[model samples]
Target chain A: MIEWSHWLPILAMLPLVGGALTPLLFRHRPAAACFWAVSVASVTSVVAIALLLRLVDSGGFSYAVGGWLPQYGIELRMDEVGAFAVPASLLVLLSLVFSRHYVARAVDASRVSFYYALVLINLGGLNGFLVTGDLFNLFVFMEIFSVSAYALVATAREPIASLAALKYLLLGAASSLLVLFSVGVVFAMTGTLNLEDAAAALALSSPMPAGLALAGLATGFAVKAALFPVHFWLPDAHAAAPAPVSAVLSALVVKAGIVGVLRTLELFGGAESLLQPLLHLVVWLGALGALGGALMALVQRDIKLMLAYSTVANIGYIFIGLGLATASAVSGAMVHAVNHAVIKSALFLAAGAMIHRTGLRNIDDLRGLGRRMPVTAFGMAFTLIALSGAPPMAGFTGKWQIALGALQAGHPSLVAVLVIAGIVVLAFGIRVINALYFRPPARVAVASATEAPASMWLPVLMLTIASLALGLAGTPMLEFVGPAAQSIYGTLP
Target chain B: MNRRRAGRILTAVLIAALAVPLMYGMVQLPAPGHADAPAHTNVSAGYIERGAELGGSENLVTGVLLNFRALDTFGEVLVIFTAWLAVAAVAGTASNAERDPVPPSPVVDYVIRLLGPFIAIFALFVIVNGHVLPGGGFQGGVLLGAMLILLSLVMDAETVARAVSARSWIWLRATGVLVFAMVAVMGLPLAGYLFGLPDEPGLRQVLTVALELGIGIGGGAVLAGLFFAIAGADRS
Candidate 1:
């Protein structure tokens, strides 16, 4: 008689439920809609914290909706793996509360309301995807987030936004089709779409069907995760989207695919042996992406574009961690995912504020703006330090763990790659920082420079604080993230 | 003037050059597989047998809709709801305009008035016989919404707005899902999953009907809402 099971799922739905109701209740008052969105997200943040506490104390719980239970109906399973996602998703939504004013100034009125709705839906979808125990049900929520994301980008109404949306749409559709094809193959072989059931079936089956399914599923996730060659749509989409959308997309949405792949790996137990060569390929591709994305970012003039390319570099780091495929590496990857989201969101929002307040899109135009907007400049600086793996910051913690994990796995080359990429990151970050704080500002921006509204600064500030907190509280955070990795790697004992 | 002509010629030549490879690639690749596999068990045969056992109706599609894939249908209804809200936000029907554009022309209005009754009749038929028929909430809802979009095109946005606002549509959609989820939940302590009530045919039949009707109303309103929003934008 676990009471928490029922209540947790309900709590997850509160933001979604509020989002669904907001348009109706605040039909004529768009401002009220925004306020209500914040309230719902804030309430959800509290609930998520409570759930995190419960999970830490008692471990995790699973509840079957409608009481049909697994093998017959959908189930929401919350293990340590799922628990990690809850707080991350809550953190992303809470940041949106701060990103609202930036969005309001950047996007049109209709698009603003729609963007809030989509963000709420995205939060629900991401959380639902993590908690779900059923494979096909995961696909359903993935589609929900994908569709919302495509629409959200297009809402920018810039020509570049449309082009980016189109590219993302095509790539997303192709990736989804690949995923569906894998599900079909797996279901055909096992006669079940439930994760546990599929695992049970896989344990008894021949290698062929399992191999085919793994190949299809990995390809799908690789495309979504923006690994290597499939990374094309990412730079454009992130660069072209409004700052808040870019933040959410880079920090959270892309990680959904990473979560999918990790879940697949954990479920199918030597699902790896079937694709061992592919995993090696993933290592090299990730290394290449990391090096290439950083080099490209170094040459970019547009501040947002540089951050967008840097995200590709960050994603590559995540991939390298995953490809190591050991307990330590996987834990490193998960922690990095959380760390990257916090820092990346902060950076993007700060960049957006800089652009909005001064009407300057290029780094060269943002010269000596620290005097004009010290707070935004500081926020950007903090995120930059974290992104560059500075001491006592979230980014440093993730990189330290990953480097140790790489060394442990005997892949010392990856350490070199990480170091080189870190240098590239540092160089570009200093470039932006110098442009903002040291270089002489262009007369135009010097005249117009002012701070963005509190709505915008708040999210950016919270994210930067989170990045610092991650560094300072690395131990406790590692306690939770470590077990989550152990769960996925099947090395809990 | 000559430069413009030269530019047009250059563009045309580039297009032709691009189209050659595009056409060649389109023909050479293996076609996409969109068809359902035929190797599976004849689902219809099992469906027919079960349909008969459960006081089945003639519509096999409807039976499957209200039975096998009811949850997917529930989500489908939500997609429509999302579209409706999206449209309302775009239209701004409540402010700035007191009246809708003029009603449809004589011929279009005549056709709608003639078809409206029959359309209403068909919707009810689909909703009531969902457990026995091929058309369920989604298909029937689309049909209903299509008629409304058509009506608005011939009539005006104000007429449709007067009939229903964006606010009402969201309420209707939420109510539908809540009812469905509740019914599903209520059955949990007794029946199991939302629609997984029992093998005892009668209760399943009743639950199915109730769920479908709710979906139908929701589906219809969502369609109208979206159509109204798109049309309303064009009007302004």
Candidate 2:
């Protein structure tokens, strides 16, 4: 019998191969392409879920590609971080289901198959990035997902989409170059591309090159994650992409950057002197991003832009938890990564459904849509509240833990930033909710709009329910990522 | 204008500040090509010591690329394919209405035609001999792609496109990913791991050659497809 560990590589390969065949087999038949893409994602989700189950049952495991040892070849490992493939696959699946209707209008008909193909390829890249233990493989998978994401941003028919995509591509390419350069640096210093082996070597190597690698990696991933000070490329790119595309970008892609940082921390875990200052600096950056992103979101007119800035704010929260380097803080950050992904995707998809039905994107323009498109409107309103850190919802769990962590770390002032940012988040959420429900219909489309099709609203409703469920399951979720935090940071405060 | 100039100056100053530590880090690294350098002493030493016997190819680079770490190469191949997909998805395939106004010069066209067959032969040799020689799938594929582009430049793009059907073109472009996937799965049952080469020398050589061919053909087709999409060829 084949060991369950063997399925690890399949988690990534299945989607990649399925995606590669999509355009070949269903170039003209877009509906068939969507069906094929969703089926592949569904299967990938099953494989990822199975791997997660095995990981929980037996702890972490690694598979050597091509039967070579880890030191000599690529290794795909399933750990708590790799378990992220579960949500990544499921979100991509929902987005694909949602895209069946959304893409018909948002993208050119000639490119529908290509769009589905790119999404699948992007998922494959993310899965591969999550599981791989080799430094070079990490860079390769990053490019795979990064390239597809840049292209997906351009698939929107809007006039600004290409420009936004160009901006995204330019920055993304530069970040990727930085990462590749760091990989080269690590190899030069250590002579091994294996993460475990390199980490061992880096522990004994000179500090200067190791520090450079760390800085290069941290900056590269920060750009990808859209952390403050380098986040200028995010608002336009996320806002201009199609809604489902935005959901994937906001939900999974940015999280990959955080994962990259976690991997960097793991690689340099032995070098505490190098990490201390970096950790301290990121806390301030995270605080600035949290407050600044929330404030920026509060002022946005475009609904998607608001959601985009909200993502930046959530990323800030995650970073703060990471920077604290306490058990509760780091675990809270990891849990929040998943929670925020679900909440953000729900918001984007609901916003997408509204735009699909009414062709309006302004918060004020969507007045009184609650009664007209009840399911989509309710999903959006509910997720928006949850996004603002309301109790018994996904956002609250992470914030509460992160706050407790701040006090534990003796950084009580950071709690003020959290609270103020949370309030600003709530203010914007309430503003959108008020316009959605309390105000009178201000546009003809809002007054006349009907509910979106089942394909669109069902995913939104499912994610809305998931956001609530994940909140209740927060304790167990925290425990699940507990060991990961310890393993990544060596020892927490 | 004054503000822009100030911004540029500030950017320069910041870059210079950043460069100081970067240069310090670079200068501290062990010199390249030294016997004691980590690059020479670590994992590569093992690769050099036993690669021919265990890695299944005489050329250590190809052996490592196709055997030891095939997954990275697979990702690289997919990246190339995705690049073509992105181009086709974004800019779209060329329409019939848009055509090149200036025709190719007769002399240049004839010379390209004369050289195409020889280039094709050379690329195939490079691809097939990759296990022992310096050239490999990527190098050979680039050559093959350039030949196709050269042919397209000299001939009517439509006539060149008609060389293969629209349906066939996509399959050709996907050859790298499909074949790599097939080989990867086959490895699980045959060699007990994904992407493994069989222990049998003949079978391993066949699989390696097959991989080189797939990557070469797929990469060349995708490259030509990219040129066609950008140069206003048939929409296929």
Number of the predicted model whose DockQ against the real structure is largest:
2
Most accurate candidate by lDDT? 2
lDDT of 1 at A38: 78
DockQ of 2: 0.85
Worst 10 residues of 2 chain A by lDDT: A484-493
lDDT of 1 by residue, A1-493 (tens): 5356665555445555566666557655667767877787777667667777778888877776555445544667776667655555656665576656666666666546666776676676666667778777677667766766676666664668878988998999889887887776666655566787777666665666566667667878787778878999998898888787788788878888888887777657545465466667777888899899999999999988898888888888888887777677777788888888889889988888887787677888888888888888899987997898887998877777778878988899999999999999999999988987888878686656777777777777888888899888877777777777766644322
Which DockQ values do the candidates obtain, in the order shown? 0.15, 0.85
Give all TM-scores, in the order shown: 0.84, 0.98
CA shift of A85, model 1, Å? 3.4
Which 10 successive residues of model 2 chain B have the least lDDT summed?
B92-101
lDDT of 2 by residue, A1-493 (tens): 8878788888999899999999988988899999999999999999999999998998999999988999898988999999999999999999999999999999878789999999999999999999999999999999999999999999999979999999999999999999999999999999999998888888778888999999999999999999998888899999999999999999999999999999998899878888889999888899999999999999999999999999999999999998998888988999999999999999999999999999999999999999999999999999998998998999988998889889999999999999999999999999988998999999999999999999999999999999999999998999999988877876435
- Model 1 chain A: weakest 10-residue lDDT segment is A484-493
| All candidates: CA RMSD (Å) | 6.1, 1.3
Which pairs of residues collide in candidate 1? B59-B132, B59-B133, B62-B133, B104-B154, B104-B155, B184-B194
Clashes of each: 6, 0
